[model samples]
Target: MSPHHEPPLTRLAWIGMAGLALVLVAMSPVAGQVAANVAVPEPDGYRMENYRAPTPASLRGAQVVDTAQAHRLWNDKAAVFVDVMPRDVKPPNLPAGTIWRDKKREDVPGSVWLPNVGYGVLNAEMDSYFRRGLAGITEGRKDAPLVFYCKTDCWMSWNAAKRAMEYGYANITWYPGGSDGWAEAGLPLEVAKPVE
Candidate 1:
């Protein structure tokens, strides 16, 4: 071998060392954190069951906001904050002429409450209600910034946000923490009524 030339085994060892370094970097804690923060893969369809469980970390075509971000949007009035918590309905089996009273619901102040519109499968009536509610809030502007929420660990907001995306609403946000988070943060809430 010449004075400046290296043996084939030495060059191969150097390449192996470089590959090992790359693997170590990839397995580092910082790298693991980065990987953890990556968006969770979206499900193929709406979450049909277990509505009150931990939801996915992300939704395709929607910005996922935290409690603070949601507050900023509400305080600035930059987006339409929507609460999708379902409302209890009167039982049809009740005696004739029985007076029915709805359970009171408190939500983020100034939020539009669209009850029962967040189900994975909405009937024709609920579908129309959701569509019209969005139209009314955005005044037919498909690009309006809309924030959706329900309760912490609830998947209804996720489904609703996805449905809004399907409806061609250009700007959509999903606040996974929802009202529970807001209240837990000592934020104020007000009684809400479903849109007629």
Candidate 2:
């Protein structure tokens, strides 16, 4: 009689092994948590704005106002609008629909074009300009209600807003939507003209 050896694995055994491995993976707490997180829907409106805890980013620390509310605030003359964009980001040189407006002409009708503090990390000249602009605004009314914003999710506005709050502005609203929100709402925006 010939010596018999075990048969090379059957197809059913392979299938069973795969299914068992899958079940074991699914039972893990890490897998469960990942599935739950994936199933959860993201927030629709701005909820992070009202958070009392320290925020990690720009709009996180400041009030997040909608375009409608911002428009109303502007109409009511309740806010002193300030744009925090660098000179390099404005329109004409950029697209007509570009968000960042630095120059006087590009500024919103009544909004002040104050370059953000710490423009160039290495250049002292740009730093000085930024400091002067910030100091000028914060000198007298450090507690003044000032609204500041840049591009959406862009840190320039967020950093600027945070700096403003640090400077003692009592009320600082960070428009997370920024210029995008303004244009999206069909709100009228004044274009800057060269003062010849």
Candidate 3:
């Protein structure tokens, strides 16, 4: 065979090796990190869908805390932890006099549970509720340290933290690990009730 006339099998083997190289590069840790960023890109506004999906690692204008930091804040009474988990509403279309049961939620020992206030958009009532709840907890002091959380990998906490910042709160902490992490760390939790 001439110098330029390679065997067909040799050509096929070269193509396969190139393909494998591309696949390995795509599967690298750096590629995985890039993919994760693309999958969970931060939104200009609140997250409107898939509230339970993986969330961004950071929130602008807020500090993201882990389980241990959250516990320290709780112990020092340095922050008022807010649980933004949504409460299940009784179906209005159910038969009249139907008994509806509500699920019980447990959160950090002293965290305030503010149900239904973490959605992307809030009605006047919920907006007012969230505003008033924050004011009540912080005693109208916008600079009071406030920690917000829901569940692990949940965006509700992120939305709530951002909302608090929008409301002119000066000190805000986002506890991404949330109650799940707290429980996993062997911390105590208490039955929670939404702020009225």
Candidate 4:
């Protein structure tokens, strides 16, 4: 007899479940009643951002990858796997009794966690920092293969991949299947260090 180890459901299964949930919601009697019967709340100006990985033709020039591609790069030691997740930022002027909770970072195996390199805003200081950090990792080789990732639906990896391309890294890959995707694929992860 063998123990049953359940990895995250396959992507298709997850998508199917999500679609079913939506259908169920739309069919609910009270919720699906006519618009005039329900009181709508005022809009809060909050909108969700699309974080899904772009299609091949929509990814600009960066190569989008799945778990298989991530594995191939990692196993071959053919690329520098960089985790571009940003550290949590705490706002100033918090209430005196406030306590900020921190989330632990468990990045993909063999990844160099480099925070701040993937900020959406492109600036001189950040650019310099990323360039210097990348130079140290790639030994100043502009053509070094670089794989960037963080978490699923995370824009950090996308931003980092673009930055790497701008810096002349000839081999660049955007692992849209980030840490969560890696886990869902039944791959192991490790506690990430704060610095590279």
Highest-lDDT candidate: 3
What does candidate 3's lDDT look like per residue over 16-131, in tens digits?
99999999999999999897667566777999878998998889999988898999999999999999999998888999889998899999998899988889999999999999
CA-lDDT, candidates in order:
0.91, 0.59, 0.92, 0.74
For candidate 1, lDDT tens digit of each residue in 17-100?
999999999999999989757665568899898788768888988999999999999999999999999888778799998889
Please say which candidate is ahead in lDDT: 1 or 3.
3
TM-score of 3: 0.80
Q: What TM-score fits each model?
A: 0.78, 0.54, 0.80, 0.66
Better of 1 and 2 by TM-score: 1
Misplaced by over 4 Å in model 2 are 1-61, 89-107, 116-131, 134-139, 192-196
Kindly list the per-residue Cα lDDT of model 2 for residues 1-196, writing each as its tens digit.
2224434455567678999999999999999888644532223232233222222333444676877878887888887777765444333576666577444434445776665341313157654555566566556666666777655544556556765665556688876566766877777667643211
- Candidate 4 C-alpha lDDT tens digits along 24-125: 887788565663344433222211244343322124566778899898888889888999888876779888989996578998888888886776565797
Q: What TM-score does candidate 1 reach?
A: 0.78
lDDT over C-alpha atoms for residue 105 of model 3 = 96
Ten residues in a row with the worst lDDT in model 1? 35-44
Q: What are the runs in model 3 whose C-alpha is more than 4 Å off?
A: 1-39
- TM-score of decoy 4: 0.66
Error of 2 at 46 (Å): 20
In angstroms, the error of model 3 at 112 is 0.7
